[model samples]
Target: MKALVLAGGSGTRLRPITHTSAKQLVPVANKPVLFYGLESIAAAGIREVGIVVGHSAEEIQSAVGAGDAFGLDTTYIRQEAPLGLAHAVLVSRDFLQDEDFVMYLGDNFIVGGITGLVDEFRRARPDAGILLTRVADPSAFGVAELGTTGRVCRLEEKPEQPRSDLALVGVYLFSPAVHRAVRAIKPSQRGELEITHALQWLIDEGYEVRSTVIDGYWKDTGNVSDMLEVNRTVLESLEPAVRGSVDTASQIIGRVRIEEGARVTGSRIVGPAIVGAGTVITHSYVGPYTSIAAGCRLLDSEIEYSIVLSGSAIQGVRRVEASLIGRNVDVTPAPAVPAAHRLVLGDHSKVQISA
Candidate 1:
């Protein structure tokens, strides 16, 4: 079996950051989000993979060159536009020719991995298999309505009136029979050929369609809040280690990993946090669920539940929480002035102010 990982899209939901970087490449616990999916595919014993990339093809290729790091032989298939999920499968025809493959959305996070799902699919070999999870907001995702025998009966793409709370997770398994379905479906009202439509086609054509409702953690890290939540969830299982230098004046609490070359002095760091390599934290309070990336500096600052990217510096900031700082950015306290507010936000930016 092969894998098709979709890493292309205009990530408008994660503005400003996605404006400059690929959404799939955004780091969770100092590692790119897409890396987790690729590793899972490798673990599932899928040796050959095809990555669907768009405008950020060069960057994705640079990071995942030859797929040697992930134990898979990767082929890059270019998608000239950010079409729908079905369109991605349509474009990957040559690479996925007549092969049963798994389609993974690169920016999606599934905690337990897809090994079990892959095994299940191998056993049943259904014409189409989709993973479903109960979500609070079914309208935000493609939802599925199951039939009497627990088969998928109907599928809707972000329906206004959802029939069920079971939202489609980003992982899907399909046999070569899906090629006919993709070709038979028409573009949705949104001007794209949605995968949900293609699955519905398969069901209408009397093909077996399977659905599994996963109870494990799954998230599509498309927005900042979701990203931070996923980061915090992953940190809960952190194993503590300190390969870096911590001065006697510093206090390291539970489950924190300090990478090599990082130095901590006169500071206190709480549990389930990570200090990346070559970072320096002095006279600061690093609280739980915080990930400071490599080459960063935190001085006289207090941070918790936040992700600071590489080469960024946060100095003299009293406190920061639930924030995602981009790479190579500098954050410092403003000079003393009258009480006022200042913010230069980008598109879709969300801010909260204490009253």
Candidate 2:
């Protein structure tokens, strides 16, 4: 079996940061989000993979080289536009060829990995199998209708009135039967061919469609809040290590991994946190659930539940929490300015100023 990882789309939700970098390349625990999906595919015994990339294709290509790092051979396919998910599959048809493949959204994080799901698919050999999770906001994702036997009866793409609370997770398994479904369906009202629609087509055509309700953690790291949440989840499982230099004044608590070349001094870091290689933390409070990437510096500041990207610095900042700081960015306190008061003394207007 092969794998098709979708790494395209302009991440407008993560503006300014996505403006400069690919969303899938955003780091969770100092590792690119895309790498997690790649590693999972490799673990599932899928060696040949095709990555569909769009807006930031060059950067994605450079970062994922030959995919050998993840123990998979990768082929990068360019999508000229950010079409819908079905369109991505249509474009990757040549690479996917007559093989059964798993489609993984690059920015999506599934905690337990897809090994079990792949194993089930290989055994059952359904025409299409979709991973589903119960979400409060079903309208935000593709909703599936299940039959009495728990088979997927229908699928809807972000419907205003969802029939069920089960939302489609980003991972999907499909046989070559999906190629015809992709060709049969026209673009939706949004002018893109949605994968949900393609699946609905498979169901309408009397093909067997299956669903797996995942209870494990799964998130689409498209926005800042989700990114931070994924970071926290990954850091919680970190092993304690100290490859870096730590001064006597520093205090490191549970589950902290200090990579080689990182230095800590006169600071207290509570763990389930990671200080990446070459990062320096001095006179700061590094709280739980924070991942400071390589080459960063944190001085005289306090940060918690945030992700500081590579080469960024948090110097003299009082506190930062639940933030996603981009690479090479400097976050320092603004210089103080003298306070002044001005009053618009208009006719019949009452004004008050504190002395």
Best candidate per lDDT, number?
A: 1
- lDDT of all the models against the reference? 0.95, 0.94
After superposition on all C-alphas, the RMSD of every candidate to the true structure, in Å, is: 5.2, 1.4
Candidate 2 stretches with Cα past 4 Å from truth are 343-355
Query: Where is model 1 more than 4 Å wrong at Cα?
Result: 338-355
> Which stretch of 10 consecutive residues in model 2 shows the poorest summed lDDT?
342-351
Instruction: Please write out the lDDT profile of model 2 over residues 140-229, one tens digit for every residue.
Output: 999998989898888899999999999999999999999999999999998999999999999999998899899999999989999999
- The TM-score leader among the candidates is 2
